[model samples]
Target: MNARQPCRERRQRRYREQCKIDFEIRLLKLSILRGHEKMTRATEDIIDSSRE
Candidate 1:
């Protein structure tokens, strides 16, 4: 039973680490998407201004 306790704890720790990594990756992806959206908006504004 004692050996099982350590093994279980190790698994829990690894799961938490993986969750943290996943969260960071998601955040990075969201930031990149937002940057692209901003760039697209800026480009549209430029085109509109040039048409005028």
Candidate 2:
């Protein structure tokens, strides 16, 4: 109904975009960490098998 409403809506949109970006970043980091752990476990298994 006024100019202030448009400004408020713009700010809300920006905030939502920021949250989306942050969530994606977090997911990327978590997947990277999980992949690293899997690699480490695979290497350890290879070492164990070689020792036998």
Query: What would the per-residue lDDT of candidate 1 be over residues 1-52, giving only the tens digit for each residue?
Result: 6779999999999999997976676566556767877545665455446434
The residue-by-residue lDDT of candidate 2 on 1-52, one tens digit each, is 8979999999999999997976676566556767877546665455446435
Candidate 1 — which residues are off by over 4 angstroms? Answer: 38-52
List candidate 2 stretches off by more than 4 Å: 38-52
Supply the global lDDT for candidate 2: 0.70
Worst 10 residues of 2 by lDDT: 43-52
The ten-residue window of minimal lDDT in model 1 covers: 43-52
What lDDT does each candidate get? 0.69, 0.70
Query: Each candidate: how many clashes?
Result: 0, 0
